[model samples]
Target: MTNFFDQFMSPTYLGVPLMALALTLPWVLYPTPSSRWLNNRLLTLQAWFINRFTQQLLLPLNTGGHKWAVMFTSLMLFLLTINLMGLLPYTFTPTTQLSLNMGLAVPLWLATVIIGMRNQPTIALGHLLPEGTPPLLVPILIIIETISLFIRPLALGVRLTANLTAGHLLIQLIATAVFVLMSTMPTVAIITATVLFLLTLLEVAVAMIQAYVFVLLLSLYLQENV
Candidate 1:
């Protein structure tokens, strides 16, 4: 009961709700309906440069849809903020949980499926099992395709959750080590502190990298299926 109550009311639970609010607040404050600058030239040029950079850095993740590309970039930004928040001494990283990552990943996979179906309803399922497949292999191919479809979101969730959890656990272990060393050797503690700080910087990089990886994979899946 204690564990259940704590899980329900913990900062980890609240943080995700707050993050969703944060994501939507900007739209509310700037209200696109009243905006005169939705397609400003400067913004377009900026997006162009950013897209070009992402194309080079995330070669495999790139899909041809401009709208999907923009959304993918935004998702990366949001995930990066949430992941890096854990490094702030007192904050929690919600993405470290498989459930939270699943929340993001499942929607992405669903969107790909729904949109792909709508865009090409007559052949969406057919695309998965491909034509010219052996008559005897049709049933096998269908099952394989179904499993592959399910694995898309599963892989996405596992990758993000594992990376974020490992990074946070590593930071915690290093901090514990530093504290232990401080008791027996002052110089060792100082060295450990420096190393820990360096690792914290690396964690920030990992946060950004993982976010990119998630978004990139999402885009790739959408492109292939849609």
Candidate 2:
């Protein structure tokens, strides 16, 4: 297990799963659906829809089809992959690393803010200021808003990092205890092992749930701000 940890922690390989996950999840969830019309005419319905409504006719891709579904599922799948990857014996959970979690959270936060500002330029700053702010309070309000804007990404990063770090450490400690106890007596060891097994299962579920929750929050932020 120690050897396994060393191998898993190797820098060259540590990020491969994250990269593969980013690409593979998007592909798997948004795989191209087959159609006779597309094969015969070389014009996929999806492509045609985009060409007609989005580019030519000036419309948004809000038909609530593969585009939206794929966006959501992709986020969830990537997070889940990262979360579960940690559960594999000896693997260092990427989410437990603040830098990795920050990498994800920062981009999402920026995207939400940038998209909102771009789409609603006039209202974006005002949204932060609120209507009741007094004339003298405008400068203070601006400072507060700026801080809040920055805090969003920081908060997201810390939240995931804290959760993963604490959970992984707890599991490791429990497993260690069970192993030592098992050496002392077979019967007690068996019971301890059973508890460890249950904790492992619970840990897996928590990891997945945390990933889902992270993505869900990002989606909500996008929906609200964008």
Candidate 3:
């Protein structure tokens, strides 16, 4: 029997070639931007979503942080597209890979920390030791806070990976059950297939939400720094 987990593994052609096609597929599907009096519905809807999301995300941030508007918006869209695409038949989710997730999380998280340290060193270090820390417990609290700070990126990566992996595994299990029962118990199989369809819908929501949460948390982190 094929291992259900095997689907999560990264596949390659000719020695693990970069999944360039999968990465670029979403961009290719997007309607091109046009300069005209009026635009198509798809382009208009895309513009509205981008505008709304950018406004909401930057609302809490200061004017200086507004510089990141483009980066954050692009990141959100990229993650959302990649995640939704993964749900298609025979497609692989690159976000399910810890390496890829960490590659995203660590640099962004580190950049926030760097900005905090460079721009507002006092306030940033102040986060390490809370106000009115007891004299005797200061060392312990500082060490704990430092550890927590470092753990943020790991948490980000693991949360995305675990959620995607769990949802996909559950869908696969239910699907396999449906297939197995079809030959002998057509009625039960039909019911199972219905449940599977519902689960797939739920997974679609999950994929979108996880991508949002990932970007949201990064924004919060950026807010702290800038």
Residue lDDT tens for model 2, 1-226: 5532333242445545454443344345433657554443333654554344223211222332223344555556667777887788744565667777788888877877787788777767776687988999999889998788779888888888787777777777777777788768878878878887898889889888887677666665665554
What lDDT does model 2 reach? 0.66
lDDT of 1 by residue, 129-192 (tens): 8879999999998999989888989999999888877777777777878989998998989999
TM-score of each model, in listed order:
0.70, 0.67, 0.95
Scored by TM-score, the top model is: 3
Worst 10 residues of 1 by lDDT: 1-10
Model 2 per-residue lDDT at 93: 61
Clashes of each: 0, 0, 0
Candidate 1 Cα errors over 4 Å, as ranges: 1-9, 12-64, 121-123, 130-138
Off by over 4 Å in 2: 1-8, 11-69, 90-92, 134-138, 185-188
Which candidate order results from sorting by TM-score in descending order?
3, 1, 2
**Error of model 3, residue 78, in angstroms:** 0.8
Our model 2 lands, by Cα RMSD against the true structure, at 7.8
